[model samples]
Target: MNTPTFRNWQSVQSEVLRRIHAREWPPGELIPNEADLAIEFGCARSTVNRALRSLAESGLLDRRRKAGTRVAAQPVAKATIDIAVIRHEVEEHGAKYGYQLITRRIAVPPVSVSGTMKTRAQDKLLHVRALHLADDAAYAVEDRWINTAIVPDAAAEPFDVLSANEWLIEHAPYTHGDISFSAVQADQGDAEVLGVAPLSALFAIDRVTWDNAAAVTKVRLLFLPGYKLRTQL
Candidate 1:
């Protein structure tokens, strides 16, 4: 197996699949052992093991002890992500779609921000702040920081026509992202942006994306008071 350079397991898996499909690691080729992958990924051996095990169970690879793992001669599965457009999501609920770009800037990421991204202190980010509306009403305020080092073209885009969330779905292609959801009392800044009273309860969604070797973006979206998100598994 060829060693993958990605920092995250999800990205590693995606790259592994890509390489397999591209014949970089041809079918029946023994892949690099898990220890080598763990070192390359800068993660625990268990993490690499988990990703490889998943691939094996999906029939993309065949795993065996001592003999190690190899790409399956007949790969049996493929995965696809259905990225939904936020505008479509809102409109599906009978709400009109409106978007406003609040601010756009290129800045050195702050210490706190750098820590979250696992990036160096001097890294620059393409910062985008915007509001998403429903029927001309505030629906959400989004604060996003794009890692310019990972996706340099982000600095050249004109975001006035498309929200960062929408633009990223088209520009960035990653297998998965880390998402965290929480509820918090809106601060003055968040409240003003979302057109709600300070201290009002709101829902927050934070997401961080990664490619093989670097962090791609970090975003925090604050929903207006009374906005509810529902999903079924």
Candidate 2:
């Protein structure tokens, strides 16, 4: 059989998604290895790797180092937490969005934060705290630290009109990152900012984004009580 020429990784990804959706590759079925797919698609192994990686990240495939790749029997509903912008999130709910810049300063981050970002303890980072509102009500509070060395423009941007969260989405495009979700009781500071009672349970999301291998920023977002995060598989 003649191999089909794929223009790019996206083409390969689309074809893979199409097959999975059409059940040509059924759930729990082992898919061809990257070498085989590359040859079939007339593309390089790296191209196939990128396509598969994207699908795995989206919760469509399960990839293991030694076990190879397989379609997920029960695909997880992955949230778009990696690239979600606060402003867009609020506006998407049909609510009038508002932003407040609470604080901005250059300071040494905590030891834990420094360790997570892999920055030296002596390095000064740009710290920014802000609140996002929906229809004039408290929505979420953002505590963020930016690496000035990696994002010099962050220092000059006042973060008054636009939030650092939205700004970074526009300016700093990351290649890879990590995100975690948890529930926490609102502390004094979180309560005051989110207009919730102290010790009230709230949803928290911690994210760290990187440009290639260099850390760009780390942020913790605490949402008001009763906030719901939903995604479809």
Q: Which candidate leads in lDDT?
A: 2
Candidate 2 residue-wise lDDT at 93: 89
**Candidate RMSDs in order:** 13.9, 6.6
lDDT string, candidate 2, 60-96, tens digits:
9999999999999997765553246888889988999
Off by over 4 Å in 1: 1-83
TM-score of 2: 0.70
Per-residue alpha-carbon lDDT of model 1 for 16-78, expressed as tens digits?
A: 778888999999999999998788777788878878888887888999898999999887665
Q: Between which residue pairs do clashes occur in model 2?
A: none
Candidate 1 local Cα displacement, residue 58, angstroms: 14
Model 2, residue 32: displacement in angstroms?
Answer: 15
Off by over 4 Å in 2: 1-82
Which candidate number would show the highest TM-score if scored against the true structure?
2
